[model samples]
Target: MRDALRRLSQGEAHPFDVSTGWDVVWEHARYPQKAVLGLAAGRLAERPLGPYDFKAGECRRILTRLGFAPVPKRSGGQESDDADDAAEADLRQRTGLGPTEKASLIRARRGQGIFRQNLERVEKRCRITGLRDRIHLRASHIKPWRSCSDHEKLDGNNGLLLSPHADHLLDRGFISFEDSGALLIADALDTRVLDQWRISQPRNASAFRAAQCKYLSYHREHIFLGRED
Candidate 1:
């Protein structure tokens, strides 16, 4: 599989098709097969595959092993951050923030400050779960921070207060919300995993603002899986 991947990287014609190669890699490769396929596909195609093809976790692992860093997948139809190290260096210099400060800013940007305050005003509890405790709730961005524009980044309507489990599922694209606030579960997600997480299909949807509806449309088109339409 590695040899096939290497040959594929070099633009050489290979006898094995992508699916056949994937099967061999999935069966025998020590590394995650999706990562191997993602790397090969990304290299050859010069573009990152969607989460449905190579999940965020697998892509991160693949890039890390190849001496590259990972950044958030963009939501506005932009490409992945190919120059991750340069982008990080530029961020550090531009912001004059140390590692700890940068980490703090990231957390704040994702779920604190005016964003969280506004979300709290509109939503008193988790949208999917009934958990109301502030300690257990997170202000998750509908359009992720790294993907958001400056205005969208702090837009109150673009956020949701969700319990940790729901937040995880949403962030990783295992689930998403329609513009009308219906829950969307990825087809690729295992039922066993959902059962283990004690998550059920949410029947009651949250109320969405006009702006939130726009952001949710983007999520459905770019982030959510299962629907090809």
Candidate 2:
């Protein structure tokens, strides 16, 4: 756990997968305090907790510390932060925070902030495709945000600007990158099908930043499916 947390905090490679990590951690943490700590550490979900589900003020405190001001929710529900605080305090009293827990929270919070700032820096557009449609773009973490505690999640160097489709491809390892910034088309990618998707033009290989390339190295080694031309 310490090793995982350390990697997450530094934006280094980690083994955790985001989509399932949160649910798994939430279910496994016996203590509410530990669970809340996990959530705050970016171990629960890639995005912020819901506003209606959490008091604006409390959420603001956490987000503010991480450099993200909580936004008002359009819907309604009991505030999660209030409930979380109550539950966490009880659990914390029952079992004080361990060293691992404290480190994880610190890392998670910092990482999340870095991610938000990167999104703003790129103006939330796919650097390669140049697609600027907000709904179709994603703040993609090169090293998935959820895998790290807090600091790793927010590190701008750990992310990439991509369209939803490109994000999906990259996220799933169907596509990846070389250190030189060349797109590593998956071997299993059907050329006929790819042509229909309109992604054939070879990119200039200069759009990716050095930090972004570091994360891509992980994807290339661990995820990219190299099957075809």
Using TM-score as the measure, the top candidate is: 1
For residues 20-70, could you state the per-residue lDDT of candidate 1 as single tens digits?
011212222223234445556755877664336654445445554664433
lDDT of 2 at 160: 70
**Per-residue C-alpha lDDT of model 2 across residues 1-229, encoded as one tens digit per residue:** 3333334345543223221111112222211112233345544566543223433223334543554322222111133224334544543455566856654443433333345565557445665687867556666666654344345555666777677677766766567777776777754455675576678646645556666676766555444543323
Candidate 2, lDDT over the whole model: 0.49
**Minimal lDDT window, size 10, model 1:** 17-26
Candidate 1 has a TM-score of 0.57
| lDDT of each candidate versus the true structure | 0.59, 0.49
Residue 18 lDDT, candidate 1, scale 0-100: 26
TM-score attained by model 2: 0.47
